[model samples]
Target: MARPSQLSPIAEFARRHDPDRFLCALFAPPERRDALFALIAYNHELARAREAAKTPLIALMRLQWWRDAVAQAAEGLPARRHEVAAPLHAAIAAGALDPADLLALADAREVEAEEEGMPTREAFAAYLRGTAGGFAVAAGRLLGAAPALLPALQRAGAAYGLAGVLRSVRSLAGQGRCLLPQDALDATGLTPAAVVQAPEAARPVLAALAGESLATLDETRTTLRPLGRLAVAAALPAVLARRDLRRLSRGKTVSLDPRSLGDRLAVTLAGFTGRI
Candidate 1:
């Protein structure tokens, strides 16, 4: 592992707050590593709005701050002072990041800021598209990946993102949160209260979602066959995402937390072999 002393501030922030993504970012070329980390770190801050805000209004205000910062950065103006802001602006100024995609990701977080959870299955998928999918698009651009390589990256992001959500069904249930589509919950005859009280019963629903995520990931693999190593690295986190989905499909109640050596080894192998 790289020492904190060696990693840039944004890189360290990324590793601490979003380790799985940090691992994937580490594969970018040395010169681009910091920019990738900046992107990840910025995304981390966007997610933080949920925990830090006192209410939905506060959360939306927090997200608006990021949108404002991005607008400033896009125009080469000074952005609001924040740990991640300068580096994020630097990434954008270098042409490695896109303001539009960053704002889109922030826009997605508005759903999270709302008191109501995702209204429907379609809305939930669209949320993931705007959040994780948008992040992958930014990372791919930063890595100098071909525009043609983006759809695969977005699919990889959605698969990995959904797998992570499904893996946390129990824990999120305990908190009265459900990442599943509202319709899916209704279809399963599971209510938010029911899930919180008996997370075990939510397994079938979570397993079905995991299977869907796994299928999405498998489809992405075919797209990977033609990508160069840099582009492959951009979506490499999908390897662990696949492992997680398989675990859920088998009814294994694994924690959503990273598996340290196992995760590193799996992605390292995929990175070396370019096999997805």
Candidate 2:
């Protein structure tokens, strides 16, 4: 195992690409942190499918390749020898992750790659259930969380994921993508294309979505109280998510990262107190 302060290749990949989860992984036990790092890197690859591919078809192909890698890891066969795949395979092979949950994330990223926008709030929630919720379930498993905690983790994760989506509204719009519900946009005289054309105009809609996310996070407080140290550590991102969601609730755009010492201190306290 790498020393607590040392960075391994997979850990470095996660640190560079998925800073939120990377920081959370630091709170894990040293011996298990590498597996968490592997999981985070694999999740990053899944989340980046749209950004990295030239065509939706190409993106689906990349997701399919990851699916195949997960299958191979589950079967104890050798992975295809990629940097992220190799350690990710070991994680799955060692029973630190569930193949089904990982596959669900890949499935959601497929929609992310293929769909233009969500047709309704229900559709958006379902997509998040698969991607963020599924990811939290897998991460909780890695932390040795009891099965009873999985459902709550899913809820917390989905709420956090919504905050992330809300935070990225301007940037996603700039990329010609809008994740807000089409029905809501239409009611507000905005279309997905319009959101992309003028992201600033969508602040009210984004604030509404942020309010919903905050509500969801608030619901998790009772469930989150059951978290032990490792589980609390795993759910620490909710601290920052809540912070951003509150800002978004007020119709203000915020950075994906606040880049403040307060962010770390908040997470540390949330982890230490077993509350999110």
Candidate 3:
């Protein structure tokens, strides 16, 4: 086991790669911030596994390693000696965090490895629920959110997750992947290849996706309003989603950069105001 002093590396990784969640962690109770960062950093590791792996077999193996590590940590056994795992083990052992939620997150990434576009809208929603929604539920637990608030957190996470997918459409297309559903492409008279080759022509398809995301975001905010400050804080990233959707609607390019000054200011205000 690592001494508490050694957890800085995990925090640093979260700060560098997941700045939005890293900023959100600052609004968490000081004692819980490190554990929150560990969870988010662990998410980053799993979410990027496909890109990091040259082969599907390698990605599967990497995900399996995380699955086994989470199971071991849940049983109070030792975990592998890696930066994210060590701190993740510490967080899980501390209670509040759930190994099942982490396992579901790892499982969700398999979709990225095996498929280019989701077959249906429901399938995409499920993917977001498992990955992003699961993370919010876990983070909310760490913040002592009540059971009633879980659904609200899941909705907020789904909205935020969908927005993230929309914002990354161009980049995902560049990677030879398209997260847009096949039905959506068909409706727009576009194809997966066209999304990558003719992004301008595909703007309407992206805009419709953004519209759905905005509606979900509205619902999330309404659901979380009665849950109080901590719940609102947990859903702060929805503010960025709303902003991105607005940009997409106006024919402006969505900025996926986490470190943008406008994003920083918007997130900071939402954190202080406890509204998204």
Using lDDT as the measure, which candidate wins?
2
Return the TM-score for each candidate structure: 0.94, 0.95, 0.92
Candidate 3 C-alpha lDDT tens digits along 177-266: 787777888997788778877666777877887777776678778877765566455777777777878778666777676557888899
Return the TM-score for candidate 1, rounded to 2 decimals: 0.94
RMSD of 1: 1.7
Candidate 2 structure lDDT: 0.82
Question: Candidate 3: misplaced stretches above 4 Å?
Answer: 1-7
Question: Residue-wise lDDT of candidate 1 within 58-101, one digit each (tens)?
Answer: 98999998999999999989766888999998888888888998
Top TM-score prediction, candidate number: 2
Off by over 4 Å in 2: 1-5
- How much is 158 displaced in model 2, in angstroms? 0.7
Predicted structure 2, TM vs. truth: 0.95
Give the whole-model CA lDDT for all candidates, comma-separated: 0.81, 0.82, 0.80
Off by over 4 Å in 1: 1-4
lDDT, candidate 2, 1-276, per-residue tens:
245367989999988888787877777777788888888898899888887888888989999999999999998898878999999998898888788888888998877775666989899888887787788888888888888888888887887788888778888887778888898787789998888888888889888888877887877857777778866656777788788889899988788653579887887777666767
Instruction: Tell me the lDDT of model 1 at 247.
Output: 86
Q: Which of candidates 1 and 3 reaches a greater TM-score?
A: 1
- Range of the 10 consecutive residues with the lowest summed lDDT in candidate 1: 171-180
